[model samples]
Target: MLDYSLDISAVERDLALPDLVAEGEELDALVSAEADWTQPTPAQGWTIAHQIAHLAAADANALIAIRTPEAFDTVLKQREAAGPHSADLEADAGAAKPRSVLLEQWREGRTELAAALRDIPLDRPFPWFGSDVTATLTVALRLMETWAHGQDIYDTLGVPHPPTTRLRHVASLGVAGIPLSFYAAQLPIPTVPFRVELTGPEGQTWVWGPEDAEQQVQGPALDFCLRVTQRRPLSDTALQATGADARKWLEIARVFL
Candidate 1:
């Protein structure tokens, strides 16, 4: 799935770019197959069109953020001034467009964003919604969003989304997002560290944190990814937690900001 060795200890653009392309291409195929874009997805209030629109808009925003930090700040200001539901508004606006037009925009934006990420310097931080991040985290976020949103489309279409090693990126991001998940849910971050051991698609083991940590999470990699992305309910996954903090983290896990 990756050109070099898969070292998700830090997700560089090389690893994320191909995975991003794979995820986008998969969703693109599903949406392109349907003549009707008005079909509703599992995401409440979001249609199939809404899903693609959101990805397109997000990719466009990421492109600007990577290429020109100053320009991205203006975009951020506009989103802020638009208020809390601004993201929904952006999706709504794009969803209003013709399906063919929206598809073209999505493809173009994705291509451009991937290209920009390939050359971006990893040292500089750029403005995101309320924070700044470098290209490394930026590309990983793009991949995670693409895969997570693609899941909604897949479910709506009754198509199976086979797990791939590309998910290593999403899994890593999900694990790293433990703190953010707690913060988002208004829960205090746990002081104790967690050991996460997931069985990958090919039956390989992917582990994070101290192996001897008392609080632990063990499960299939796909299940962990689905849980953290909130695509699948915790009750439905094969994941197991050994302590209070580990269990609570699964309840509110989220990979996106």
Candidate 2:
């Protein structure tokens, strides 16, 4: 029988905070050159500035969610009135700040968020996209966001994103996101076990799901990360799907809740 439940309980709960710090520093270096700010990224119509702005806004929100409920509610209400462009509006406003100011704010914001994530109890629920969620999921979400945006920035700059063990967080998030992915797409849940087997950058095997499951996905970890993030298309990847359900899951798999 297939166990389709998305029990993230199996995933290692560690935030891998050092990995988060390293990726943040890597992105900082990418934008250190002033000219790089205006360069357009893979996100259509979004420049590098927009990419950084989006990240900064996310970090700032993390801090708000962790430290101040009142502030978070205020911002959430504002976004509600602004409608769909709400996020875009925030990003644009963030991008308008002086480059140094924006970068410093991001640095400080993420630094604070990192600290909160480090100390917060795993079971504590914090405000997230639509509901309260645990610190574990929060960090997983942040890892994917940082890595996904970094991929766009790197590709736009004609560079490769160096895959690291940190991707374990992303890979786990991708698997855990299965239920939410279906829910957001308004599709019926496929009660089929799906396995993911990937070779990490160092040739280590990283896997998810039951080995006995009939459906499986196999490939490099980087490819899995890119596909789930939607930064790169499946056609561009080397991943092989061995079952119909796995194929369909790949088509709509997304990290955001």
Per-residue accuracy of model 2 over 73-166 as CA lDDT, tens digit each: 8878887899988778888898888878888888888888888988888777777667776666676677779989988888888876789988
Q: What's the lDDT for candidate 1?
A: 0.85
Worst 10 residues of 1 by lDDT: 1-10
The TM-score between candidate 2 and the true structure equals 0.92
| Stretches of model 1 off by over 4 angstroms after superposition | 1-9
Worst 10 residues of 2 by lDDT: 1-10
Model 1 TM-score (2 dp): 0.94
Q: Give the per-residue lDDT digits (tens) of candidate 1, residues 1-257.
A: 11111234356577677888888888888889999889898888889899999999999998888787789878978988999888889989999999999999999999998888887776777777767776777777788888888999889888899999888888888888887888888888888888999999999999888988988999999999999999999999999999999999999998765
Once fitted onto the true fold, the runs of candidate 2 whose alpha carbons sit more than 4 angstroms away are 1-15
In order, what lDDT does every prediction score?
Answer: 0.85, 0.80
